[model samples]
Target: MPKKHLPDPEKYELGEPYTHLGIPFPRLPATFEKNSVPLKEDYKMRSMDYLDTPEAYSLFEKQADLIIENGWKGIIDVGCRHGPVVDILMDKGYTDFNYMGFDTSAQPIEYAQETWQEFDNIEYRVMSWNEFAPAGASKGHKQLGQNNKKETDEEWWSRAGVKFKVDFHVDVMIWSGVLLYEPTYHLWFFHNMHNAYGAQNAIIQEPLKDQRAECWREDLELNTIEHRLHMYKTKYYEYESWEFDLDIFSGRRIISRVKLWQDGDSKWEDWVDTHGQLAANPHTEILPSGYKVIPYIFRGKLNFELSQRDQTLCQVALEKMFKERHSHRLADNYSRDKLHLGKMYMYNFVFDGDEPVFCSGVQNVTDKVVRVFSRYFAFEKYKTDGTTLLEKNDNFEELQYAMHWIRDRIIFWSRDKSPKFFERLKVKNELFSEWTVHPTKINIIYPNNEQYIFYTPKVPAEWWKNGNYDGFFK
Candidate 1:
């Protein structure tokens, strides 16, 4: 996927939030100052444009949930101009959440603070990161002392705040529309936010300059009204927004040529020949061009959260078992099985420490399809780390017991038809005569005419050491 575009930083309106086409721009928090100083405007524009897409919001929500699951306590919205994201979170009933918003603009802060005053836990800070760093640092504390304690960062930066380096630490940090102003420093800023502050997670949304250039170039393809119609059809998905283009052909001239449906759901609909322009109803407007929205999903991981105790135990048990039974062969033994015709694969077993519950195997059945099989074993199998088939006769008996168990439960099981496979085996041998009887079930038939007959109590612990019957009763 292409990265979002960033606007020219030089053209950004410094000290105040910039608006695009009358849509209020996302605020740039002071903390991004050192990292985004020269390219601030570009960063801001890209971040804002990306967040404007509904898909971005959904992705953020999923990431937030993942972070929360790992014990993150709060969400910090960087460059939060009017608290649009905060408001959305509140409406979703994710209340009692600790929210902190930072911005360089006091105007947006005042509005957001008033609108969200009910969220007593939420805090709004109108301080530029440039000013905050120096004031908070030991060096600035010595030089700017008492005066800095009373004056906010935004107030100072708006007048005469000096630039200084600072680091950020938080649960979830967000940056939108800020990267557009600092295009070149995006990578540096990303690393700074991720590593410096040790933040649990970070989200950024921005635009791509190439996409805009492509749109401009394609506009030349539209010479006539018909050409424009075709262009719209081809590029509709790229449009952040659009209005209905109408033309009236009065005899020889179009008396009126104007766009209609300037606002709301009316302007976002699909055009219909019979009904004229169709109205669009959207649940959320996260993207600039509403029609071509692509949803993104992401999960956040806490950099500090420890792995679960249960998970650690499961991992250790599986690793030990796998190393014992299926570890790589020694260099000298590699040629021992050179004549084995069929391809062979090994499967590792995992258990919950109570009893051997499941066995899974992954193998290439043929070139066309790969098959996987899993079953629960009735008994646990534990062999010495160095044990091999040639060193132990018990291994053979163990294998036979497992085979009998599987044949009774899985190999011959049939839901829609009678187990004709089981019946056929009984007909072919005298030892399996019990299989055709009323009270007996076909468990296992051996190659030499001997049958392993299983009843309730006769099932041994070793019978379940391999992939044998897991669900069938005696």
Candidate 2:
């Protein structure tokens, strides 16, 4: 089982320290100075594990294509561990461009420098963009050491064997998987890029808190409750692309495209209020609007299980069902033989005779309710005539059956013998109502007239006598 939280430095072995802004930070194992080549199993920067993934490779390919198509001359890859971006570009047969890579880690920088030593146009530095003082800052204040003589930013760049000016012109800048480490420095980093580098276009990618919810592994051996809390609290949402103005005085503007939890209203004001405070120099005016907020719904646990034979039949049905719709793919979690039966989950299924007509994988959410991930429905068969087997009303019936199944399972799962009632059940998507899945004749619980409606299902008095674990059916 994968660990539930980040490995503890004290308990587990760590790589060599990498300095950034004169401050030492630990690198991941296998990327240490001692390791000449990163281990294949290591998912850290040394082996460029991220790029090896199918999704990441596709993304990088597209990014590389974009850079080539634009005919960019000079490229600066911030946080360019092992110079993967340069390697990708070179592999694509683009060698005329000047490339400068920056990273806080000394190991990766050293590795990159040695690997690409033959290429004089390419350069790697064991430094962060944050190390450079903003344009016009005092030379003495920006000096690294007390013993060494003070030097201006230009002089420092010159001494470091690089010709960097206040207007450090670069055609394109790439910052991938860097911002998440220091989200507070977002504004400052952009400001510096615009002021000193005269950066025209910047491609940035960061893990958002909302989208990262599903990435959590529950199997980890957590040392502390705090680690669990941290895992639960982290949210991954969206990445932003920036366009810097050529003229420095005009400043730069960023347009952010955010992914919401469930198509809810964008919490731009909330983000601005929170993130703005952390900014080195907050730009309240630049924050854009009209972005939608993704809704986060509570997914109750699956209270029932099926026999292995029944499970196989259900899986086949689900695959066919999805094929008929041509909508969703069968997720690995559902198709896998092993199942993780736990609290806080939800599942959907419709049966025609002994075989399932439709099924949705059990959905799970973290305790913090920040992340939610689930597999889609699978069908057993598709209509050759290109018509759906179930009509609108039939679909409604199936949904009703599924809901009743949920209610019964919930009732059985509850310890209380009396009729159980819920204050409200909220769904952001209108499809829930369109599919006629919304429960009717339910009381309006909230005074504010919210979307959620009350539900009270009566359970038989004798139902509790059988005990909660009464197999899959009532």
Candidate 3:
């Protein structure tokens, strides 16, 4: 048997307390500093004019929409030049949010203050990032001296906090078009603004380095030492953060949305605290031909090196089975190259002694319809030949196992991200409509002054038609 590295919920490692770490400045190409645009009246006008195009302002508006949609109420917009976000908020008739916008350019700050003076919970100030976090502004981070003593990096960060110099706390921060200017400290500034600073949510949009003009790319050099998104590798399955990326400007720029929290409740959700439960909790079933199918869950990307052989075996078996059934329409597509063995999130396979008879997997997060575009394969006796004469070729029972696994994932994700966020998100299944999750629920009240508004979405036993597993839910 291949070595299995299943998740241990009790031992979920939270890679780091703060991922947005401090880094030294890079060697620059003199042009970036010697020839930079001045932050003045003309710059402010160009910024305001840039908003005239939907493409320019849509980024800001989307951030606003997400903030309101997700129930986030505070914003600390870095590089808030001329306050485009404030305008978008006011234009949308939204007055519930508290916004703090700061820019080094006095002209833009003055213009924004004068333009939106009467608004409540809105403030603009002329402040430099240097003033916010002196270490991030310079060529490198130096030991900060505090109380006449050299502060340790951890102590410095603790005392320092994202170094924005603000007294109050805001759960969300947005950085739009802000990285374009930081040339050297772009990622450094980025790491500090998002979850690295303890913000519950972060939205960042910036030009892609590869897409920038050659001259601009050479001048506005970003650090190659680390990537903004790659910083997330250590944080995934530990039940903390979930993220989504967006393409902007027809792929010229990109937007990264990062949320640094998930439900780890032991009562409603115990998966986070105990990953071992996933493997221990198997969905076993007996096929009509009396072949037993068992499902085992694996976490993270499946190490393809060990499973590559089984994967190919399943692929070849599937193609042969399909061809025998005269189903070339789909059989031709079951090539070994399409197994996608390396991308499994919650991986499941029925490996009987290093021989994979069945396999299926799905990613942790789902788009539009909280559903899975599952990758599954199973070995079956398509023809009545040899000792497998009683075997059914379709492997419908294995497919149902895959469906059950998908439902398990959807429930885990809905609870982790909050089921309310997925009200319109459906559970779609192309193969079997009976297994699909319907968008209806019946409320139940708890006794003794208690109310469980929990959305306990279920896959009713009646849907199975017959007790296929001989009381599987039992």
Winner by lDDT = 3
For candidate 1, which ten residues in a row score worst on lDDT? 294-303
| Local error of candidate 2 at residue 429 (angstroms) | 64
- Every model's Cα RMSD, please? 23.7, 24.9, 24.8
Q: TM-score for candidate 3, please give it.
A: 0.38
Order the candidates by TM-score, highest first: 3, 2, 1
TM-score of each: 0.28, 0.34, 0.38
- How high is the CA lDDT of each candidate model? 0.34, 0.39, 0.44
Candidate 2 per-residue C-alpha lDDT over 374-411 given as tens digits, one digit per residue, 9 for 90 to 100: 34333435223325322331333333333322322222
How big is the positional error of residue 40 in model 1, measured in Å on the Cα after superposition?
Answer: 8.9
Clashes of each: 40, 31, 4
Candidate 2 weakest lDDT stretch, 10 residues: 278-287
Q: Which is the leading candidate under TM-score?
A: 3
| 1-474: candidate 3 lDDT, tens digit per residue | 212122232232212221111211112233544443322322433333433344355666777776777776667887787667766766676767777788776666666676666665677876655433433234355322233344454554455533443433456777766665555565555544443333556776654545323213233434222244445435422212222222222124556666544543222222121222211233344556455443333344432333355455544444554444334334533455554434444455554444445554544433211213234444452223445422324334554454443342322221222343333233332233323222333221112322111122223233324322211111
